[model samples]
Target chain A: MARLSYLKALQRALIDEMSRDESVFVLGEDIRVGVNNVTTGLLAKFGPQRVLDTPLSEQGFTSFATGAALAGMRPVIEFQIPSLLFLVFEQIANQAHKFSLMTGGQARVPVTYFVPGSGSKTGWAGQHSDHPYGLFAHVGVKTVVPATPADAYGLFVSAIREDDPVVIFAPAGSLGVRDDVDLETLSAVPLGVGTIHRPGSDVTVVAVGHHVQTALAVADQLEGEISVEVWDPRSLYPFDWSGLAESVNRTGRLVVIDDSNRHCGIAGEILATAAEQMRLTAPPRRVTRPSGAVLPFALALDLACQPDAEQLVTAVREVAKD
Target chain B: MEASLYRMVRLIRRFEERCVELVRSGDIIGGIHPYIGQEAIAAGVCAALRFDDIITSTHRGHGHVLAKGADPIRMLAELCGKVTGLNRGRGGSMHAADFSKGIFGANGIVGAGGAIATGAAWAFLRQGGGDKVAVSFFGDGAVSQGVLLEAMNLAALWKVPVLFVCENNGYATTLTVSESVAGTICGRASAFGIPSSTVDGMDAAVVFEAASAAVESARRGEGPAFLECLTYRFDAHHTWEHKARVRYRPAEEEVSGRLRDPVEIAGGRLDPAERESIDEAIEALLDEAVAFATTSPAPDPSTALDYLYGSAVLP
Candidate 1:
């Protein structure tokens, strides 16, 4: 058994994919130097041609990746800061995402946009702190937010291999979490699938990215009083609705813990779908950031804005009572 | 040399004139950004490119698409939103593309095509293909976009074989180049240490000579080259002006701008009989193009999302 950190899992996924397929290349600002450590040693192994260090031109390079993908190369772009996604929204959303439909099926932009430090890093205020996985999901781009090291490796590998454009947001909170796993057992996890960490009968706790750990811990703390099922959806868009329905069917109640804003966030979508289609005995609840949240620089303010274990526990208890 | 360049200019001129008539007769919807005055740049630059080379065009793109060997009838059908169009009615006016003929696409966004051309060139090189070159054509307005600057840096850094052609027609939708851009246009490329030159865009021969040298350098793997074609627009930005009445350029200025029409300049090179024959041939082509476009069927609403994804449906 080996303990793999989330960051190391990302690095291993990149190395494995690049070694497995020559068409898989990494491009971003300061990637050759491995500024984020997710691309460590990749430059030395793949060389400059495969591990390209692009200029700080987010729009240009984003579209550059789209073009490369269309021309039969799979490009993985690393964003140092999450806010840079806003700058290249047009490139990814309007250009790359639309290429398949706009070109009469002549093109496939198999580009993977990897954001290593998404969400809040304490003291990194307004500009640096953003979790925009919800935006990608809204635009129907395959969006993934991995919670554990093993899932990180599996989802990233799947995103790279996917024929459509995929956005993998490696949350800052989950980057440090390590998982003890068998090295020989590491394998590709299919997208749009949910993993149940703990099966229970009272309530199903749907968690996203970093919140999965909180849900599991809360479930452990409330062991005998409530039977909690922790469900981690590795991929956000084309979400594992069937898997979620099965979990909810067993538990009969639902609570979604997410680090995004309340309005139009992934949590809202989960609750809405469960209410509309899924079999739920009681009304579902969601713990999320305030609507239109802008995380402040102070540690306390940042913590206050994000969905925490306390909120998850409270929401779980509320859903249980329902 | 001048006569051949003039012939291309005449061809583009008549081609666009027929396209404008198609717009009026409701054959081509969503009126085009007519390339009426800036014909010399497309004519001259495309004249230098081989059939195997590729070009990525812009919104005012019919000239480059046509000059790069797209069939006139198919292109007109595209503008008409017909099923027989280049992209089968999916692209409409702003997104006509014919990859087989080496026209990657005519993008609607400003300054967005440079990196696409660079990436395509990189792919060509990586595949061990011949030293095929790519040309990205944009306007003076595109010079201010940071993405274009980034693309220039990437092209220079990777030593990709591409030619960045900037057609400086002054206005980026009503704003003059002097009012919008801070530094010189060619300076943007020169800043990346890529060899850049400014040529007389109104003269087809000069543009052809400059583009030929740049294209040859790129084919030899000498990295990217940038050419600033100094020209002016002889028509409004869009045909909507025929009804909207948005005035930007002075009336006298417009008259002076159209004075050295590239068609007349290039037409001067051919013998009178040769010029007459070319004119007759172009007219006939335009007639057939208009007829075909007018008769072509519009795309069905049921299959609008036919190309939404490349992969087979997930079972």
Candidate 2:
């Protein structure tokens, strides 16, 4: 067993995949020197051919990845910041994502978009601090946000292997997370499966990305009074709706803590799905950043905009009231 | 070579005209972006490419797709939105692709295919996939696009074998080159240190000669080359413009612009009897294509999202 940090797990996954398949390569800005650390040592191990250092051209490289995928290569693109996704949104969402269906299956864009420090950092300001996984989910692109180190490795593996475009967001908050993992036993986690981390029967707390840790902590704090079941939906687009239904049915209540904006977010969709389909004793609630949230540069202001433990505790408590 | 280029230009001309007719008759639902005057560019460029050479096209793409060796019957069926079409009717006019023939796709977004072609060229090189090069067919409007310029930079930097074909049909939708582009089109390639040239797009022989040199140089690993084919649009930008009456070109200008027709220019080189036979054969082939397209069934609505994933499962 070894202690693996989330960042380390990402690096290991890239190393393993590149070693396993000659078709697998990584491209990003300053990836050779590992500016984000996820691609650290990749240049030395895989050489410059496989570990390409692209210019600061998100649109160019994103679409470039798509093209390489079309030519039968598995390309993983590492974005240093989250908001850079917005710059390449058209390339990813429109061109790469649509190629399969648009070309009637003649093309398979097996490109993985890995955003290392997604969501708000301490004081990265507005441009660098946006978490837009919800946008990709809304557009039907396979979206995953792994909360733990093991999941980071497994999901990154699956994302690279997946024969479609997948955007995996490793939240800034989760970057520091370390987990005890048996290296030999670490394996791929299939997309669209949810795990109940700390199961209970009173209220089900659905958490996304880094918020899964927050939900687990909140569940622990509310353990004596409320039986809080924490469910981590690692993959957001092919959401494990059946698992969510089963949990909601068992607990009779639902609360979601998502890092996205409140309006039109994945949390809203989860709540609506539970209300429409699942058996719920009380109306569900969600904790999320405000609609159109732009994380300000100030330390406190940025923290204020992020979904936190206190908010999760309140949301879980509110859903448990009925 | 001359005869084949003439045949290709003629085929694209008639195929597009037939598509416009189908649109009028409601056989083809969405109107197509007619590649009427720009046929020689596709014919010339595609002729220069080998069977394995890849190409990524633009919205005005029927000519490119046809020139790249897609079955006209299947292409027509695609345009008609039939299950038997090239993309099983999912892609229609703007997104048709045949990977077997190395046609990457006909993209709906302008200037999007440049980077894609460059990347494909880079991968092909990495895979030791021989001297196969990639061609990206875009318009005068795409010259100003940052992505295309960035692609040129990457292609030049890595020495990726890519032929950047810019079909300068004078206008981008309703906006002319004077209104839409700044500086020069070939200057964009020159800025990236890519060798470039401007050629007459209406003459297939001229375009073929220029494209041959670029494709050959690229295949030799001499890096990328750019060709700016200056042509005119004889028909409406899109068939929708026919009804919208969005007139930007004057009557006199339109008359003069259509005079240097690619079909006529290519046909002038062919023996009169031989050209007549080729035209007759094309007419018969197109007749069969139209019949097959209209008769083929539309895709089942239940399978509307089929092939959305590589697994062929609707997620």
Candidate 3:
């Protein structure tokens, strides 16, 4: 068994994919120098041609990735901040995402947009703290948010290998997580699948990205009182709806804890879909940031707005009540 | 070179004129952003390109697509939103594309094609293929977009084989270049270390000479070049103005603008008899193109998401 940190897992995935395929290249600002550490050791191994450092032009490089994909190359673009996704939304949604269909299947934009530190990194204020996987999912771009080290490595590999454009959001909260894993067992995980971290009969707590750890901890704390099933949906867009339904069928209750804003958030989609299709004995609940939340600069203000373990525990209990 | 350039300009002129007639007759649902005056730029640049070379075009993009070797009938069908269109009716006039011919697409968003072109060029060079250069055609208005500037930097930094063809047609939707642009346009490229040249866009030969040098430079792996083609629009920004009559340029300016029609300039290079024959040939080609476009069936509504993803469905 080897200890693999979440950040190291991301690096391994990039190293593996770039080595495995000559068409795989990495591009972003400061990535050549490995400023974010996720692309560490890639430039030295693959050389400058494969690992490119781009200018501070998110829209330009993002669309450039689309063009590269059209020309028969797969590009993994790294974004230093999660909120930079807002700047290049048009490139991803309008250009890259629409290319396959718009060109009548003549093109496939297999560009993986990698956001190293997603979600609120306490005190980073409004512009830097957005978790926009929901936006990508809404636009039908394959969106993934991996909680554990193994899942991060596996999901990123899958995103890179996908035929369409994929956005992988690596939450800042989950980046520090380390896990004991057998190196031989680590492999590419299929997108649109849910992994039950811990199974229980009482309630199914659907969590995303960093919130999966919180759900698992809450499940552990209230072991006997409320048996909790922690479900992590690796990919957001082609979400494991069937797997979610199966979990809900067993538990008969659902609670989604997502970090995005409440209105039109992934949590809302999960709860609404569960209510409509699944056999939920009680009304589902969601724990998310308030609608249109702008994370303030102060530590307390930022923490106050973000969903935490206590909120997840309370939502789990609330869903179990009915 | 002169004969081909003349033929392309003449073909584009006749093609656009026929397109306008179709618009009046209610065939082309959305009237086009006519490329009547900017023909030389497309003809000159595309003449310098290899068949495998790629190009991304702008809103007024018929000339570029046609010059890049897309079938005129398919392009016209695209304007008419038919199944036989280059994009199968998914892309209308503003979005027409023939990827097989290396015309990535005709982007509706101003200044967006530059980045895509740069990316394509980079990819081509990275793949160890024959030095395939990409040409991005945009208007004076595109100079104002931040993405274009960013693309210039990326192209220059990476030494991507791309030609940034800026068709300086004086006005961006009635705003004159003098009023809108603060600093010089070519200086933007110069700042990024991209060698640039300004040429007489109305003279197809002059544009061809400049583009040939730039395209040659890119093919030899010398990096990107920017060509600022000084030209003017012979028609309105769009056909909607045919009735709206929004006045911007004075009558004198309009008279002077039409003085150097790209078609006439290029056609003058050929013998009188040869020019007449070319015109007749172009007319016949346009006639067949219109017939093909109009008779083609419109695309069905059900298969809207037909090409959304490359892989087959999971089930």
Candidate 4:
């Protein structure tokens, strides 16, 4: 057993996958020097052929990865800032994501778009702070957000092995998390599967990415008074609907804590699905950032724009009441 | 060599004309951007390439798809949206692909395939693909797109074996190249230190000569090269323009542009009897293609979302 940080778990996954598959390679800006520390030793370990330092052309490299994938290479692109995803949105969502269906299954792009420190990092401000996994999920690109160190390792492995284009967001809020785990136990965690962090009988809280930590905290605080169940949906797109239904059925109430802004966000989908398919005692509720939220520079303002434990607590209480 | 080039140009011209007819008759649902006058470019460039060499194409891609040796019957079926088509009707006109033939895809987005082709070139070499080159076919309008230019820079930087072919067909959907492009099309590659040349796009032999030199240089590990094939569009930018009557080209320019017809330019090199036989052969082949395209059954609507992911069970 060893104590591993969430960022280190991601790094370990990259090393393991690259060692396992000759086709696997990585490219990004400043990745050679490990600007984000997720690719610290990859350059020396994998060499320049596998570890490429691309110019600051997000659109170019993103589509380049697509072409390489078409030529039978598994490329993992590391985006230093989460919002750089917007610059390559067309390449990933419009181009790579559509290739499989557009080509009638003649091609499969096994590229992993790895965005470390996704979502609000205290004072990064507007351009660097946005979390857009919801956009990829809406476009039907495979999307995953692992909240634990073990899950970070497992899901990153699975994302690299996935035959389709996948966007794996490692939330900034969870980057500092560390857990004591057996190294041998870490393996590929299949996509589209959700895990129950804390089982309860009253309200099921669907927490996304790093918000799983906050939901767990909120559930602990409401322990005796309200039975709050925390469900972490590691893979967002191929969501474990049946798993969500089972939890919602047992608890009889649902509340979602999502990092995305309200309008057309995954939170709204969760609420709608629960309301439509599950037996809920009260109307399902969600705690999300305001619609069109642009995180302000000040620490307090940044904290204000993010979904917090307090909001999740309130949501769970409201949903459990009826 | 001349006869083969003439045959390609004739095939593309007739195929596109047949597609336009199908569009008018409601057999083909959406309109296609006809590759009428730009046939010499696809034919010339593809003639210089081996069957294993890869090529990425643009929205005006039928000529490239046909020149790269995709089955005309399957391609026509694809345009007609039949289950028996190249992409099984999943990709209609703009998105057809045949990986087995090294035809990566005919991208729907403008300027998108350049970077993709460059990356493929880089990987082909890295994966020990000896002397194999990739060709990216885009229009004059794509020269200004940042991604395509960025691709040129990277291709030159890494010495990736890729050929950038710019088909200068005068208009980018009603906007003239003069109105849109600020600099010479070849200058875009020159800025990236990639050797480039401008050729007559209407003369198949001239284009073939330029493309052959560039493809050979790239294959020799001299890095990437570029070719700007100056041509004209003899048909509407898209079949939709027929009804819209968006008159962007002057009547005199239109008449003058048709004078240097690629088909006639290539056919002039052939004997009268040989030209007539080639034309007859093309018409019979196209007749079979059209019959196959129109008679093939439509894909089941229930399987509309079948190939969305690599694993059919992902969703």
Q: Predicted chain A of model 4: TM-score relative to the true chain A?
A: 0.99
For each candidate in turn, the TM-score is 0.95, 0.99, 0.97, 0.99
What's the count of clashing pairs in each model shown? 1, 0, 0, 0
State candidate 4's TM-score: 0.99
Writing each residue's lDDT as its tens digit, candidate 1 over A163-267 gives 989899999999999989887887787888889988889999999999888999999999999999999988898788889989998888999999889999999
lDDT of 4 at A240: 91
Clashes of 1: 1
Q: Pick the candidate with the highest DockQ.
A: 4
Q: Which portions of model 3 show Cα errors greater than 4 Å? A: B312-315
**Pairs of residues clashing in candidate 3:** none
Two-chain DockQ for model 1 = 0.54
Model 3, B69-171: lDDT tens per residue?
A: 9999888988998889898888887888888999999988999999999999999988984889999999999999999899999999889999999999999
Candidate 3 chain B, which ten residues in sequence have the lowest lDDT sum? B306-315
lDDT of 4 by residue, A74-157 (tens): 999999999899999999999999999988899999999999999988889999998898899999999999999999999999
lDDT score, candidate 2, position B16: 94
| Residue-level lDDT tens digits of model 1 in B1-315 | 666676668777887888788778877778989999899999899999988888888999988988888898898888888888888889966788887888888888998889888887888788775988899999999999888788889889889999999999889999999999988998888799999999999988889999999999999999999999988888779989987999989889888888988887778777889889888888898889888988989889999778776653221
Best by lDDT: 4
Model 2 off-target regions past 4 Å? B312-315
Q: lDDT of candidate 2 vs native? A: 0.92
- Using lDDT as the yardstick, the better of models 1 and 3 is 3
DockQ of each: 0.54, 0.74, 0.64, 0.79
- Each candidate's B-chain TM-score, in sequence, is 0.97, 0.98, 0.97, 0.98
DockQ of 2: 0.74
Question: What residue runs in model 4 are displaced by over 4 Å at the alpha carbon?
Answer: B312-314
